[model samples]
Target: MSEKATRNFIDAYEETRAALPGVGGWLARRRESALDSFRETGLPHRRLEDWKYTDLRQTLEKAAFAPAPAHEGAVVLPDRRSASAFAAIDRHVLIFVNGRYRVDLSQAARLPKGVELHALADVVHEQWAKDLVERRFDDTRQAENIVDLNTALMSDGACLRIRKGVKLDKPLHLLFFSADPGASHTRNLILLENEAEATILETHVGEVASFADVVTDVAIGDGARLNHVKLQDEASDAVHLATLRARLSADAKLSSFTLTLGCGVSRSQSFVLFSGEGAEANIDGAYALRNKQHADQFCVMDHAVPACTSHTLFKGVLDGESEGVFQGKVIVRPHAQKSDGRQMTHALLLSRDAAMNAKPELEIYADDVQCAHGSTVGELSKEAIFYLRSRGIPEAEARRLLVLAFLDEALDLTPHDLARDALKLLVSEWFGEAVL
Candidate 1:
């Protein structure tokens, strides 16, 4: 089954290779190389240790999705709050429909000096973009091999470069909507030079039974900072796979948060590597799932240098027959002394049929490192609910309050104030609908 699905993808690549961006260039060669690797590995399945909880090969074999066609028309955004959570934020908006950039709908004119923003095809020839695309996080090869599929078939994405000591005046929003029911692959490249700063907001919302594969590569230079927030709320029958690979230089800081509210089966993978001393990476997220939704969050934090700090926290609530998985690891290499790393995941089950699987591990090679990892899965406190109900609060309201407080810890970690508030509101609204 896996081999057949793999052949289907390979055939699609062969048919679309001519129309894909960066033909007859370095990118073209890179695409062919990635395709070869993908063909060798095929699709990940339950037999793989890293993918034991999610059988992507079986799912794709059953779905048999074709390539999403280029959509040409005005996009009708979903009616969910998450679809427009960042509408009020002052930012440059770039819209992509069916894996194709829509220049007519985008608004990113007059970007600040030293800031270069372009579509994937426009920047694929640049050295910085090539470096980011070619970079590899070998430590997590088992979990990252899926990225090869995106590298070979990626159609369009955002390319952002921030020069040294420069800061983006406002956030940059990348809005992707799946207008057709097929498949779309997107690869985003972000480069921040020394002392540079930027905030990026990403929203994925649609109501089609589609396959959305996305990869984002980020490079943060010395003394630089990046604030990233993403919201994923797609159709209940959609398959969403996203991978993020980030490298941090000396004294750099990265704060990333993700909010997952929808999708039938979704897996989000993040790999962070500290290449220099004194770097920090804070990855946190909150999710709410109901019905038959299944979501997975996989993360790895590697401390290859000394005196770095890394922390990860994820909180979620599951109801009905939904399932959630959190697999995370923090690694401190030899000679990487004084590394402070922590990882934690907590889930609240609102229904008896709901399930949660968590595996948090810490591997320390240095004697002086301080690292710990933990996970907790439990149902809502009936005693607390009764206590609130005795005080005249409605039962539904009491349950909502408890779930909100449980998830607030992770949501508070969102670096942007406005984005944090918007996420909080969305979570609350989601709970209200679920209880109804």
Candidate 2:
């Protein structure tokens, strides 16, 4: 909104670029060029089709951009000692702090044979960077705003490649955090080779005033199955913008679920490309917001090949002055004959001040494909509340029970155990109770 904020954005990016290791080198030079593009493009406006329902100018007012500096001393991760898909798994885990990797306090388990995980900074100068971008990049048929911004300034993230025919028994956890009171950007890539199968769990959390910017690109090979779970819980004063792009091959399956129960302002975009025929992609997500907080979940599912299938379910609950936005696009290319896509976006509003914006699109160039989308916003059914009251339950408890039931599907879909509990408590706290 103000000229100062725009300048602050540029200044913040410059500051981070200067502080990055190996300055003036090849990697830095490339990043500098990206920074220039980022400045020129800046943040997207409402004119963009995907961002029409959600506004970015609000973030301009909420943000005070600066690259978080190196956090000194030791910082402990929150303990969630519970049985989880993460608990049963034993793959290498990478952790980051203020956009920088923290080798300690991470779970770098012994991975199954023939798997390579790189902490981006350690390998950026090598040929792998070029190989990665060229072979696995996801412009998603179009460069969305978040992807462009993330590409321009991302400092550090993880890159993993699984050998052909290898099956990783444990899921890899890529944990990222930003404790500094500034903007933090992270970029990550995962490549599953032909006949390879792997699962990845990524967590994004911040306990300090900051902004989280992230981009994830995944290449799923033929016959590969990639299960991805992303968790978002940040300080209440934080801003988060993220994009996830996945390319699926013939007979490959990709299941992705993201949870959102934190941040003052947050938005997540998923761009799924069903490149190979018979590929299946599942998108399931939930968001709980209260106390004037806002969250947006947007998606684009493209069936570029014949016989691809996709399914999406997004649910949200808004309380107090909170608001939620959902925009979904399902595109079927002319060649993508017999494609099957189903999508639904819904939100429950608890207060009169609460609001939800839902947009579902179907762009079909083929006549044989089947695509359907729907959206809804409403309050709890009085009959259900009355039935609970008739059963002698208190009004408050009745409300809480119904809210919990509304969110069960999404939470149950959460692949990680601790993350599911963490999100449940976040929802509980939004109502007037302690998480304990």
Candidate 3:
């Protein structure tokens, strides 16, 4: 069943892709091929194994396809609790909206002494850009539609790097805004050189029934470290599908925090591939769903080296017929002995209609490795509720508080304290004071 709306959008997109400047016949040909794939595949349906539980085609068919009109130059972050530590973090920041870079709101002139940030559009034509892409993103073709399409049509995104052995005092912020009812697709490729270390915050926000499909590819060189926080709080009518892929070299370390809040149908997929010995990765997140909404979070950790470790803990709270999906996979290759990987997912259903679906998977080829995964779907504990009510709290309030407490372990894993608090307050406001 093809939706005429999506077809109409594809038509408009064809025209827009044709009219874009500076791209040559080869690039345009690639865009046409990608658009053709999109036309055939549309959005992945539930029948597809990877998309078995997500019927994204239904939501995407209802979206508008025209790129959003340009807006005035001012940075507007979604409101958070006043005391968010992120507000004071002195970080290099890039801002984008509706698939275009926001120059005014973005920081360009003054970054750390050795740091360099360039918009992808500005550098794609340069010889260095080709060299960088060849070396850093050679594995991009292995990804899905949103990723390949972003590569084919992407004109602007961020390219960031810190010099070897540099430790910066501030964080790097990548902020995305949908702002209108048009579908937005963008790509970002980031790299960290040897011995460099940094923290980055990536966030997306918007209103209206729209779509934001994005991909961020990161490559960490030897001895480098990256702390990434992904915050997704788009409009309830938005379909937000994104991938954050990271590849680490020897002795590299990566820590990631993913927040699944806002949006009607949103999913964040993370692929962390540890390619070097002694590399480390940590994944953590918290999500809350309400009002018939749905949020899907999935991650894969590939252990391809010896003496590596990865840890994952994701928790969710569902209410009002909202649903949560969590799928985690840990793969340890045969020779990758001494690998320690652990995964856990827990969900709390606040209503009979609210539901959770979780699958924790472990595929181990090395018998000497220690890898384990566990998931549980359960209702609020009556004993905990009774204990809270005994202290004079209302029954509903007690349940809400208990659920919030269960989610704290995931949120506390973030290095940014303020973002965690802001998310807590957001859940409170959305679910009422009972949840705080």
lDDT of candidate 1 over 1-436, digit per residue (tens):
3788899899999989999999999999999999999999999988877788988898888898899999997788888788799999999999999878999999999999999999999998899999998888868788555888999999999999999999999999999999999999999999999999999999999999999999999999999999999999999999999999999999999999999999999999999999989999998998899999999999999999999999999999999999999999999999899999999999999998999999999888999988988999998788999999999999989999999999999999999999999999988888888872
After the best TM-score superposition of candidate 2, give how far the Cα of residue 15 lies from its true spot, in angstroms: 2.9
For model 3, how does the per-residue alpha-carbon lDDT over 394-428 read when each residue is reduced to its tens digit? 98778767777788788888866766676666656
Candidate 3 Cα deviation (angstroms), residue 17: 2.6
TM-score of 1: 0.99
**Could you arrange the candidates by lDDT from highest to lowest?**
1, 2, 3
- Every candidate's lDDT: 0.93, 0.75, 0.74
TM-score of each predicted structure versus truth: 0.99, 0.90, 0.89
Q: Highest lDDT, which number?
A: 1
Clashes of 1: 0
| Top of the candidates by TM-score | 1
Predicted candidate 2 versus true structure: per-residue lDDT over 344-431, tens digit per residue: 9878898899889898889889998788999989999899999999999998888888888888877777655655675566556555
User: RMSD, each candidate, Å?
Assistant: 0.9, 3.2, 3.1
